[model samples]
Target: MPQGPGYATDLADRYDDWFAPPAATTDATVALLARLAGSAPDGPLLELGIGTGRVALPLAARGHDVHGIDASTTMVERLRAKPGGEKLTVSIGDFAEVDHEGEFAVAYVAGGTFFELRTQQAQLRCFAQAARRLLPGGLFVLDAHLPEALAAHAGAGAQTVETANGDPVLRVRRLRPAGQRYTSDYLVFADGLFRHVRVDFRYASPGELDLMAAAAGLRLRERFGGWSGTPFSDTSGYHVSVYELPA
Candidate 1:
């Protein structure tokens, strides 16, 4: 199993401010996820890398019972400080090997966090764990970057992240295709602070992820370019894939 990425102390403090999406985007994400999850009577939801409760908190607010497993206590601490965050049942550990007392209606890993496992074997284990956590016929949702899209800008690039009220922040990234990994650094000019966040990904293609899910007894149900049901295409940058366990 993979070890920890220490976000609690370093990145946890600045994560929400630096990476939080606009309220509209967040609402869309939560809406799509909640819909895919179906009714709450199906089962509680499980978030594999529920960071700072960005998505999880809203789902909880919508009256879904949310359980999460994460490697960073600092991240979980920030989550616990938020409203409704305290009510969540969270475990501090490797999500790839995480277990729960009961099955869930949905098991999801959002924002490309699944790629952080860094090895195909580890990613496979994560799929297996997710399968085990979900009830039969339940869904396992993944939001991941398209390998083709990342290949489009394999070497280096910069992106602008701005909220309606906040100044623009620059994000720089470099992809090393040899190992199928990348690193990102954030330049927050508004705060006059330079925060560097490095994420390494084994970067699997959609087919590879599907095979892993199959090995874990899950099958693809739907795939889209975005949360609003955009058709997946070669030019799309990211994908939201939904997989289902057999009934």
Candidate 2:
């Protein structure tokens, strides 16, 4: 197993503003998926890499039976602090190794969390594990940058983040694909206040992800270019795919 990434420590430190799942993004994605998964007000939904409940809390509030797992304790703790979060069951451990004793109606990994795992084997293992977590026919949704987009936008330049409270932070993500995986790095700075950086990895296209899912015994169900159900184009920023385990 890969040891902890230094980037995770940075994510832990910025638990409140940066790492916590943003409600707006989560709500939109979940709403779309709820319809896709045929979710009722009551859903037995599962989320992996449930960082700070961005998507999980809202899904729970919408009355889904949401369960989540994350590798970060700080993220899990922060998640429990949000509204309607008291009842959520969040595990603090490697989601890859954790034992989830039940099958869900739907399972999801959102907000580019898939790319953070760092290796093709690790990424593939996640798909295999997701297959085990789902009930037969349960949907597993994944979102990440498409390989085609990388060629179109080599090292898709700089992005900065400013917190609601204090200092501004400049963070740049570099996306470089080798074979079927993306090697990435995040250079972060607290504007002129503090400067720190981390290097990491993200992965390739939906086709690569699908191959992993296939090896794990899950079938491709659907795919969209974006959360808005945009048609996938070679130029789109991501490939959002929904895979289903055999019923």
Candidate 3:
């Protein structure tokens, strides 16, 4: 079972594999942030728990100023190793604890990082700190998995996929008790060899997320089923909700 606090430590070495994206969905949330950022500071966007530069550097490449903070030095170090990462700025600190003076046009937590905070108090503090990083009328975006998809896979199951190299892939799933964590086991067949890897993520419901945003004095502006503007529904697999810092 994966709890909130030890999540980063457990995921540190294997972070890249879990988030390893082939194409289409990579930084899918970025498009929404760019769109919602309209009429805001445009000064610089702040990313909470920005991992591996999935969205930060790309946003910077698009000519928007970006800054990010993460608790894992290992994650930040890996981000710094990436091409665009070397040039981008990242702070090695907790999003809930780190204090920055600059007001941002947009502050976001992508790839489900928002739920890593675990407890309601910590989650609320994260929102409070993140909101303070934003200027008035600034936008705060958060992406998380939908409860239905998780409930759909309540039991363990497996799927086979191929990697970019045409290697066979086997993915197994198991939902932890209370729906607080998900464990995925992946077996890869490459070079006529097979190796198994595992991944874990802490889960949060949409209602829990809404309450956290409200706790920080931020209003839920809109909720989307996916990064591509799908309307939020119980059946949707994931969510992308935008919040306001009480302009």
Candidate 4:
């Protein structure tokens, strides 16, 4: 229900380059997700916010049918331009409300995209939709950074960093603890011009997320600090959580 300056076409074109050094995380992410995927079922695997097929294409290469839903047509178009990308069935729409045929054995969102939904109600709707899209006992996986770190920086105003590509980017963030919302405004200098993008995130603690998943008929099954299966602890920066629908 909440939307802002979502992934723009220009930003989509530079996404891969901006996140270069994909080898650092992409391989591990795909490997762990593939393991979690287990044996392929009759239904295709589903990826929410499947940006540029970063994880989906690799999974599809492993012979599992893969479908994706994303709100960015530019991102989907970039995915389509890749080798073997044409094999994927990607729909352009909000992953939270998009309708896809058949049930999925596994559904996931990577890179903290789950937090992009700016309201608890919308997030709950997403969980319900995922439950409806999955077969009984199907898996739902989420990868997100903990809010504790951001909470530490409440009302810190603007910060800037230079990308590896020599672009200077400025970020301004405001955190609202009462609603567990974090809003970010990014200004990126590229091609001798500056562009702005705004993103609002609704973050939940692990326990809160479990409750939301339960409301949607999913039970927590597994959780880890990272892709290597490290145990989650208070000091952990991010978490990968898996939930299951009742069989």
Q: What TM-score, computed on C-alpha atoms, does each candidate reach?
A: 0.91, 0.84, 0.81, 0.88
lDDT of 3 by residue, 41-74 (tens): 5568888887778778777787888888877776
For this target, which candidate reaches the highest lDDT against the unseen true structure?
1
Off by over 4 Å in 3: 1-18, 98-101, 161-169, 177-179, 188-199
lDDT of 4 by residue, 1-69 (tens): 222236545577776655322454778888888888784345678998888888889889999888998
Give the Cα error of residue 107 in candidate 3, in Å.
1.2
| 10 residues in a row with least lDDT, candidate 1 | 1-10
The CA lDDT of each predicted structure is: 0.81, 0.69, 0.72, 0.80
What is the descending lDDT order? 1, 4, 3, 2
- Candidate with better lDDT, 1 vs 3: 1
lDDT of 1: 0.81
User: Per-residue lDDT for 210 in model 2?
Assistant: 79
Q: Tell how far residue 91 is off in model 2, in angstroms.
A: 1.6
Give per-model CA RMSD: 2.1, 3.1, 3.7, 2.6
Looking at model 1, the pairs that clash are none
Top TM-score prediction, candidate number: 1
Give the per-residue Cα lDDT of candidate 2 at 25: 57
- What is residue 199's positional error in candidate 2, in angstroms? 4.8
Candidate 2 vs candidate 4: the TM-score winner is 4
What is the number of backbone collisions in each predicted candidate, taken in the order shown? 0, 1, 0, 0
